[model samples]
Target: MPKILLLFAHPRYEQSRTNHALLRGVGELAEVTFHDLYEAYPEFDIDVAYEKKLLLEHDVIVWHHPFYWYSCPPLLKQWIDVVLEFNWAYGPKGNALADKTCLQVITTGGGSEVYCSAGRNNYSINTFLRPFEQTARLCGMRYLPPYAVTGTHKLTDEELRQHADEYHRILISLRENASVADLKDCEFQDDIPPQLTIS
Candidate 1:
């Protein structure tokens, strides 16, 4: 089984029911490591060496958070800026993250319908996620189609359960061999490539 580093970040985790329930389902899986960024460093002072070590240890890295202002929470942006060093995570000498897999698991208050061309958001979630996706590419990591749990504001108990169930299923699928080729089997899933090459 692949080792997964689930980097969770939410400013107001206490108020979260959807993300929390989703987390509860995945927190106990084998080879899954949970790291809450805000809980770890409330002051935003990240330890680079230690964070790099975690990246090295895991085969798959998951960024779990609620979509904030069409992107990630601030701490996540901070983590990427601080933890992924130039010569260590990229550049000629930076190959620490080469071939690793990175996936984004996000929760959104808006329904999926509103994230399309005709939707109020005016773009897909994947569109807003390009920055992250490209960053993963630069680090030589494969960026998988994001696993999204949308419509939190309107999700019924059964709907939330279904989303959580699919979440578990995708995590299991990724722990094995992961490729965008497999994304085709999932129709409603986004249109990310089978393999992404960093330029």
Candidate 2:
């Protein structure tokens, strides 16, 4: 099974019912390192060497956070600015992260329907995530479609639990069965086949 590194960032975790539910049982998964950025670096000072080490140790990297103001939280942005260095993550001799799979796991306040041409947001979620995709590409990682939970404000307890279960299943599939090819046509990880059959 591929080891997964989940970089979680949330400023107000205690108040977030959706994120709390989504991460209900993720910490217990074997070979999955759930690193809470806010908890680790409350001062917003990221440990570059340690972050790189964690990156090197994982086959799959997941940026799990709430979609804040059409982008990521400040700390996560800070992490990207410092941790993924030019000579180490992108430029010449920066092949350390080559072939790794990377994707975002996000939650949005608006519904999926609202992220379209006719909707209030006037663009898709994928459109808002281009920078993240480019960042992964620059690091020589395979950028997969994001796993998103939209309409967070209206989700009931049962709905949250179901989404949580689906999130768990997706992570398991990514760890044990799914490949880049298997995910190419998917618009979102939620669209992945239930069995996660590798083609």
Candidate 3:
């Protein structure tokens, strides 16, 4: 099983409903380590060495957060700015992250329909996630298709539970070393791997 490190960030975690539920579904997994950024570094002081140690120890890295202004929360961005050092994470001699896999799990208040070619957002969720993909690439990590939980403002109780279950299923599949090659062509999922059949 690939050790997974989840960098979870939420400025107002107590006020979150969807992201919290999604977190609860995967928090207890065997090889998944959860690092709550906001709770750990309230002052935005990221421990670069410690975070680098975690990255080196884990085979899969997940950035879990609510989509804020089409990007990540402030602390996560700050974490990236500090943790991903020049000669350590990327440079002539930096290759510690080679062959590692990175995935983004994000929640959005807007419905999936709003994030399309002619929609209000005017782009897919993946379009807004290019920065993350490029960051992973620069560090020699494989950027997997993002798992997006959308329409949080209107999710019913059953819908929320369904999404959470899907999140759990995906985590299990990833832990079991399931091949997500089918995920290459897509960039988003209502739950997880929307059209990619993983067993």
Candidate 4:
């Protein structure tokens, strides 16, 4: 059985319409543990030991957040700094996350077409996500294809609901008892359509 630990970070979740709906819709599942970093560490003081424990328990680790400055929210960077420690998360004596999987679930205010060389953002979403992929690689973790939901600001109600449902399905596919072929099929490489996790 695989345990999924979802690390959710949104500084102003209240002011958000799209991300809020996405998170809420997916929060109802059985084994999906959503850890709200902002709510958990309002003071910015993260308990590293406890967090490593969570990582140790879960088979897959998900960093869920909005695209803040083409990267993650500050709290997530802080979490990575504190939780993924040397001699614990990497380097000699570190094997905590060696075989575990790390995946990012992100929602962006920008449109998909705009995140390109000729676009305003001037980079693809996957290009901006290389750091995460490399980070997973450094820790000997399998970085799966990320789940990206774009154009949040313009999402219609039906579009939002559709994406929310897709989000739920993706998470459910990672939960304990989900098959291995399901995991392999997702082969994340950035800016791709949804993966077919099952037959």
* Residue 134 lDDT in candidate 1: 90
**Alpha-carbon lDDT, every model:** 0.84, 0.86, 0.84, 0.80
- The model with the greater lDDT, 2 or 3, is 2
Off by over 4 Å in 4: 176-199
Looking at model 1, residue 132 earns an lDDT score of: 93
At residue 12, candidate 4 shows an lDDT of 94
Writing each residue's lDDT as its tens digit, candidate 1 over 84-179 gives: 999888999999999888889999999899999999999999999999999998998888788888889889988887777777766676776545
Model 1 CA lDDT for position 19: 87
Please give the TM-score that candidate 1 achieves against the real structure. Answer: 0.92
Task: Report how far residue 107 has shifted in candidate 2, in Å.
Answer: 0.3
lDDT of 3: 0.84
The local lDDT score (0 to 100) that residue 111 gets in candidate 3 is: 94
- Backbone clash pairs for candidate 2 read none
lDDT by residue (47-133, candidate 2, tens digit) is: 999999999999889999999999999999999999999889999988888888887999999999999899999988888988998
Clashing pairs in 3: none
Candidate 4 weakest lDDT stretch, 10 residues: 190-199
lDDT of 4 by residue, 36-111 (tens): 9999999999988889888888888899999999999999999988888898888999888988877788999998
Q: After the best TM-score superposition of candidate 1, give how far the Cα of residue 168 lies from its true spot, in angstroms.
A: 1.5
lDDT of candidate 2 at residue 128, scale 0 to 100: 91
Q: How many clashing pairs does model 3 include? A: 0
